[model samples]
Target: MDMTACNVCGKIFGASSGSVCPSCRKLLNIVYDKARAYLRDHPKERVNAVDLAERIGEDERLVEILMLEGRFENRGEDAEESDDDKKRKQLLQDLQKNLASMPQKQHETGTYGSDRHGARREK
Candidate 1:
């Protein structure tokens, strides 16, 4: 029989077509379920693997693996973003709107060199 190390726990076990061992697979499934439920309850909350793992109290690595496997691909098209990100985006949009609504200043011609020296005499 062939032996291989489990991807999650690094435990050596009988080799199979899968990268993770049986025990680790079961644990991963539990984590996956928790992640799914959390995401479902908080649909509007953007989260990456690490944040999701922290919220669900699971290992970050497992969540990352599940993400890589496309388990959470179709939940929504919106990408994960933080509160700061949302704030920054809103600020930019507001700035754009403000700039667009403001009236443009009229340009005025000004003298280039030292005005203190003397004023140019027009012929």
Candidate 2:
């Protein structure tokens, strides 16, 4: 049978429903912090899906998925949660986003943190 390495952990396993294994699949998140920061710091620039994705090293589709799934955008006003749970979720999502903007150690000049990298990245 064919096998693949999980994106999150260096584990050899069969490819499953998710892109990565279950462990790392949870980690496939969006860089909302950077996106939000950019939007705030440069509101006049008008950040959108394309520009935001380019800033990182992911496609617009992938980035969108991250944000929506990450729950960065507040959905329901009536949504209730424990203060601790809310803080933990928010922190985790933010941390994931921040890390998403960073490239792996193997990546050099054209991996992330540059809009150019997105265009140059292999499809």
Candidate 3:
């Protein structure tokens, strides 16, 4: 049994993981609901963690924790990746995979300058 202090209410309790205790977790769920509702109504508008916390009357840390837990995604304009960047990333990954799959040739025997297996012959 792992013991921890709740991040929300600062209560001591037995928790396997995460900082919030069961009671606070329940309360945080309610907070999540309110935040989700707010987002739904104002889908076009942008809100930072602090602003969202203020709008829902919840702690900013709780809003951040929910975002970290993937309850919601922060799709700010600055965080958006370009399609060209995505394509370039994919192309780089493909090149790396192809390079890794190719068989490696032995360059030399025990000596550094000479090639015994003809893997790299000096002209």
For each candidate in turn, give its C-alpha RMSD to the true structure in angstroms: 11.8, 23.1, 11.1
Which candidate number has the best lDDT?
Answer: 1
Could you give candidate 2's per-residue lDDT for residues 1-123 as a string of tens digits? Answer: 568885445688887644456655544533554555555466567555777779765566645655655543542222533476578778998999879866664475644547666767855
With a 3 Å backbone cut-off (N, CA, C), the pairs that clash in candidate 3 are none
Instruction: Sort every candidate by lDDT, greatest first.
Output: 1, 3, 2
Relative to the true structure, how large is the alpha-carbon lDDT of every model?
A: 0.80, 0.59, 0.75
In model 1, the runs with Cα more than 4 Å from the true position are: 1-3, 15-17, 75-123
- Candidate 3's C-alpha lDDT? 0.75
For all candidates, the clash counts are 0, 0, 0
lDDT of 1 by residue, 1-123 (tens): 889998888999988747779988898889988998899799899999999999999999999988887878775334544466578878999999878756432232234433433565432
Ranking by TM-score: 1, 3, 2
Deviation from native of the Cα of residue 64 in model 3, angstroms? 2.6
Residue 46 Cα positional deviation in candidate 2, in Å, after optimal superposition: 3.4
Q: Candidate 1: global Cα-lDDT?
A: 0.80
